[model samples]
Target: MTTTHDEDAHLASLGYTSDFKRDMSFWGNFSLGFTYLSPVVGVYSLFAFAVATGGPASIWAVVIAALGQLLVALVFGEVVSQYPVSGGIYPWTRRLWGRRWAWMAGWIYMIALLVTIASVSYGAGPFVAMLIGIEPSTAVTVACAVGLIVLVTFLNLGGTNLLAKLAFFGFAAELVGALAVGGWLLLTQRHHGLSAIFDTAGTEGNGSYLPAFLTAALLGVYLYYGFEACGDVAEEVKDPRRQIPRSMRMTIYIGGFASFFITLALLLAVPDFGKVVSGEDADPVTTILQNAFGPVGFRVVLAIVLISFFSCALSLQAAASRLIYSYARDRMMPGWHALSRFSPRRAVPPNALLLAAVVPAVIVLGSIVSENALTKIVSFAALGIYLGFMMVVLAALRARIKGWRPSGPFTLGTWGLPVTLVALTYQVLAAANMSWPRTPDAPWYDNWIVLLSAGIVITIGLVYMLVARPHERHDAPHGDAVASTLDPDSGRATEPARVG
Candidate 1:
């Protein structure tokens, strides 16, 4: 029941003012995160790969990843609950650590988000072409992907209200489609029994399944992240300190269930599990859907899938632009003046939105260079996002060790340090698993693309930090000394704590 004035005062105490319309309700925030975490998109994109890599048992990765990410989400809930800032990881890190740490965290995260936007739109291209009855040629796919990016950019430019409405529509459509499709498959098309999920289907290498399972875990890693988008636009949500944390947790709970349900139904519905496991059925999703629903019905399902992709891309763009604007607003990057300009009429950062669209579109064009470019882009995007999450988690741990407690309405209280420690541990292991070079037959660079991409980005950020010193800018408040004094209940300042 925090009022608008209270929200504004909370933001002010954190050294920022309300520049957004604050039209997003708790449901709207949840919808935004749900669409960003787009179970349909993630399941459709990675289903074949996961099955191929780890067989039916790969589904367990979904559960395991959900459990791990829930820990991270709980840690994030405490952080965002206290900070309640628009930039999410960036501001949270700043308040927990220092300006330099926040700068790097934002830098890495912003790049990852841009790459993810490209990856999602690029993924949508095939679906769009399929829905339109066009050949999914490279040229056609690129055109479709770029067109989707442009379409979402315009939608985002329309304002937060439009964004929230489309996100909610997407959430509704995607959820209903998932349920209807999964239920129908379960009732009339299931080819396997309840125990099929436990079968490995001969995917184990040398009698050990751990490697394959870890590779397949990428599906869950990718799906769980979009929940953070709820907090990226924290300033737009009413009573964000309480509502955003709940929205984030709800996003993971609901989105995770939807993902698990769809994946389970798909596994049970496959007409030939051996065909899928042995690579005879390269596209089991299409094979199963076409067999169950026929061409016309499959096309209807494709249309729904296309909507899910569009909404996922839309949410990614929105989150990326907010991070960019947040960086600019704090003068923590070059071109801050131009990127920070907020349109009062639309209550949107038009320039930041444009940057989000343009970078991803350029990345879409990179597909012309190599057929595998999109896959590599996606790999790096996932890695980058996990790394970004780890940075925030690490900062929070450091702050807790230094005696900084979360002073928020939704704090973990005595459990804070334990949750933060576990979340950080999970993130580190997940990230290392993601970056491990598994493809030995492929070129060295191909196998190392994830780490290489991260290294290059980090190197550039480090060079820029040393040269430009954006964190030292004096126009805006830069660190967490002011934040230590914030009263958890009233969002007012008190005597400062002796921690960063």
Candidate 2:
């Protein structure tokens, strides 16, 4: 079977061994990215925020963000095609740069991913409370969130195939749900016209729409990600050199458009924009659903949202664990043997899965003390991912300037450098925008929250890299077994033989 022969051959070419089983198909790989992107979970959580910030015109920001991310995805697709390894960003960065660079990338990415789990769980808690018809207090929400994490962690421990199935189902649920609900709302409820998006109706008291639109665009910031999950599962997907890259591109193409239309439909459907933007309507999504479809419809739509949140958590955790296992397996991280060990029977990393669960659970618990914890944590989370992504882009750009070429199935050809430049520039601008002090009225810590939080993480990672000095490139699991170095000037060591 190609699963054993073809996959392992490619792995050996990239210096990775045959470890995880390659049972994932093209659709299965796509499903992970789709579910992780989780349009419903993302759009619902931020729809009101977008409306409040920039009204309909801010919807353009989603499109802009998606296009920007597509550039990043293109770079990623090229890299993953050349080296279809397990860990997405961490391992990819390690190969492109070095052990030191990779560790910082891993540190930034892993912490952000863990915070993402908590953010998704916290966002979904209110929906769970709404479904149960109970007031969602801090304690109630925390309990529901803890239960959600525990349940998903168990499902993740079961095996890869089951996780893939659930991801596909989640994709189906979200797609059908978005089209059905969004389509109906568009056709029936038309309080605003096609030009309404630029009306700037909700950005009251704010001096200019530019600042408000920028703030509103945060809704679109993290939504387009989760495509990298495909790259993370490269080792488990058959013919990953081909499939993984395609899966990543498709993840962005579909997730971006779906997010755009659903947002458009919701924005166009708002009956009273002023009230919702003013925080008078605390739950605008639920309000829109109830008014459009009545009680039964609201519940049905809520079910789809729940499934989306569940799937997003599932895929995010799966990606995070794979990152841990890949880094640790190379002895590049602490507790290498333990975190890297896969379940003999289950075919998953038991320790990594557990770490994924525990860290997020602790973050969720802290939400009980401070109301702004989730907001600040989620805000910083996007910046963290951006930081890691920029590093990867920078490394690739550096390698290319040194005459490195793609050895895998995909390449940007003449457009490689230009696309990478745009991507890198976009990430730096976006990261700065995210980290800037937005509010002059809020407390100093609150205003500088994202920057401070990011500083702490960056400092920790840099300190570890300087002092601890993790395993070098040659110390990777099969590092010594390399047969040739890909490029002489690329600072990379010998490339390993392809096992078949």
Candidate 3:
């Protein structure tokens, strides 16, 4: 059990054989998390959204969001240690609750990731325009986003090796890029002082600080995710049970801190708060970076930002494809036979990859129809992903309440139940905050967009679950034959424990 092949035996215990080539190193696994949690991409896209909604006072939302997501990530790390499977959330939920719960979780998570790809790419447009010295017109931005989606689709077809390389490159580029540019801004700029972030300038009529804060916190709730990227590709990462849990934690710790720093620095460096909240400079990253770096330095930063955007899409698509492959392999998704087709030689799921590309490409068309497309797309994604997340959290809490104990190497041990309760509470509050309508006089479609869209996604999943009533496999293990265990030394749980 103390060998390199130990992971294979552990995976087989849960009823699957390895189909992926284990080529990702600990760095590669870590890089996957970092790239997926790309700081540059998150702050660049949503910083404006936060400022407009909550002003400088909203800067603290990152810390609050990180604290909550850290709780979520800790639970995820513990689960992943025991159930180190591809399609991380889906399989983990299946092992914790049942096949039905797993199917719905996968459904929600898959759709979230798909919309995330579109949103992140849509966000990338302005940065790319800056690098190439263009105005970042709506058409140019949409085209850029669509083009990158196609590029990542082709790149994914090359297999995991290229993704690993690209992930590492992205990790380096973003870190150096953020620190170099962020560091320069803080050093060269005049003082806005610590009190500036506490200033609620434009939040005059936006209700109490609580509501405005919640809306602004979407930046954090939205930004702090994608750390689970490592677990989704667990089959490909070496020593997954150990490496993945560690990667998940570090992804949140380092990535969260970096994003907060870059955000705070940019906010403090703002020359005119009024221009940022209500004018063309709303996104601020464009103006702030250009102001700090000049046109030449701005392009350099934009280049790094572009690299991050590319890797984020690449990692996101890679994660989504694996989820499809995982579902297909279990005979759950439509056309499972064809989607399950994997080239043992190339170690890739071409059909799943194709589906992943086509869906996002179609989803990105939202950018074409809506003027405020990126915000709506992001809000939609945040809602979907948070719902998907809370399901797993609820499952874990239920299992614990029913007397289930930790069997994972990364168990929270004595603190497990308490942490689970708090985490579930945070997720519920966060999800509600994102779904609430903020506009008082807006059109019906705009006001209820988040709720309507989220409902549609959930309805589709529930209908499928009811119609199919799909089980994990034809000969799914039953009772004692498929029991859970935790080796005192290894702490790996193979199957869901039945509760009386």
Candidate 4:
């Protein structure tokens, strides 16, 4: 007995192409380099995490996080090389673990996207306020979020064509900005000591190097947050089986290396941490440049800052909307079919992009009711996303232990164990070092946030098991044979293989 994908047939009825065409050129994928780095990571919010922790120390945290995630990226590259589906981790997790685990991973992953929509909305707010020259009123914030959502949705409505164009521009802007800031700091070296960034105990608010270091590393992780967007765009990538892995691997290299250099430069450029920390405008990125170069330099930096913010927001919209389209294609969510429809004319997921836009718009408005709501949501979403990442990494490790070897286009070779270990270590540190503020201004309570995210995941998982497990069991294939589908590329229903 064969079960057909109902969603696919319905999508076909709308004249949508179910398959992601392999039309992305090498440069096309490369142009999206910034998109991989921009989302919460290489751009503005990166400064948020840095300031939240303790200036340059946060740089160390981001570096550690990057190292750990590089391990995760290795495994991701390996899987994507073989599967190359737009669903990314969801499909990879499903193919590795099978139906039950896949469903849960898919669900959790969707929630992660939803959480990101609002978080990005929050991140966009400060930039919006700065650009427009006004206080961040709730209405203005909401309008900015909504406006961006509209802009991105329109861009995505044209599918990879528009995304490709935007990706190139955004990627170029980010590259220029990162290099300009980093290069200036490196060349000037007025502060003159790279070691000062790491060694400085930081005067204000209880200066301990170890705790500060850990917190700073967490900031670094923010720069690495959305590199997985490479995988999300796997569907539209040319030679996805090979290209996806290459893109994933390159994203880590480009994004991580760029972030490291930026951090190093910013570290050297930081003049007086005490003055900057206590200053009226607390954003460390702005302060670092303003102090080093003065007002005129500061204005130039601010303009770059605005462009960086826009780039990040654009990237977030791209990734989140694609995830929504992927999930909707699976029929697990409402309006799933319609949202999955790729326009035959435009060749993009128009409805899904609009749907995704609405969510962030709602969040931006909600944030108006209270301050830092976007931050809380982003943190909240990050917790969920990181949990999914952890689970996928663990599963990948398990597959490796079981001698799962897939002949994908990309790999980390015999060093898989070390890589996985390094990644896990980074996650542990990032999770453990989060600071719970005594003051109410912090968007999240560090202690409760992680716990709450875990609780929600477990509760949802258990409920799914209790309620949905039976249906899945009843639908299982007979005679101890697990159901399988013929590979779309190969057209053969081979037994499942593990990935080492």
- Highest lDDT: give the candidate number: 1
How far residue 87's Cα lies from its native spot in candidate 4, in Å, is 1.1
Off-target runs (Cα >4 Å) in candidate 2 are: 1-3, 202-208, 477-500
Error of 1 at 19 (Å): 2.1
- Error in Å for residue 104 of model 4: 2.2
Predictions in order: lDDT: 0.88, 0.83, 0.81, 0.62
1-500: candidate 1 lDDT, tens digit per residue: 88888889878877788779899999889999999999999999899989988888899988988888999999899888878888898888887888889999999999999999988888887787777888888898889889999999999999999899999999999999999999989998998998989988888867788888888888777778987899999999988888988998999899989999999999999887778878899999988888888889999999999989988999999999999999998889889999999999999999999999999999899898876876776677888889889998898888776666777888787888889899989899989988999989999998899998899899999999999999988455555633565577875656423211
Error of 3 at 498 (Å): 19
lDDT measured at residue 85 in model 3 versus the true structure, 0 to 100: 84
lDDT of 4: 0.62
Worst 10 residues of 4 by lDDT: 474-483
Q: Which parts of model 3 have CA positions greater than 4 angstroms off?
A: 202-207, 278-281, 366-378, 476-500
Clashing pairs in 4: 41-222, 41-223, 58-216, 61-216, 61-217, 62-217, 62-220, 404-499, 404-500
Ranking by TM-score: 1, 2, 3, 4
Per-residue CA lDDT of model 2 for 154-203, tens digit only, reads 99998888888888999988998899888999999768888887778858
The TM-score that candidate 2 achieves is 0.93
lDDT of 4 by residue, 36-72 (tens): 4663235455554464446655566655667677777
CA-only RMSD, every prediction: 3.2, 3.2, 3.9, 6.2
Against the true structure, candidate 1 has what lDDT? 0.88
Model 3: ten consecutive residues of lowest lDDT:
474-483
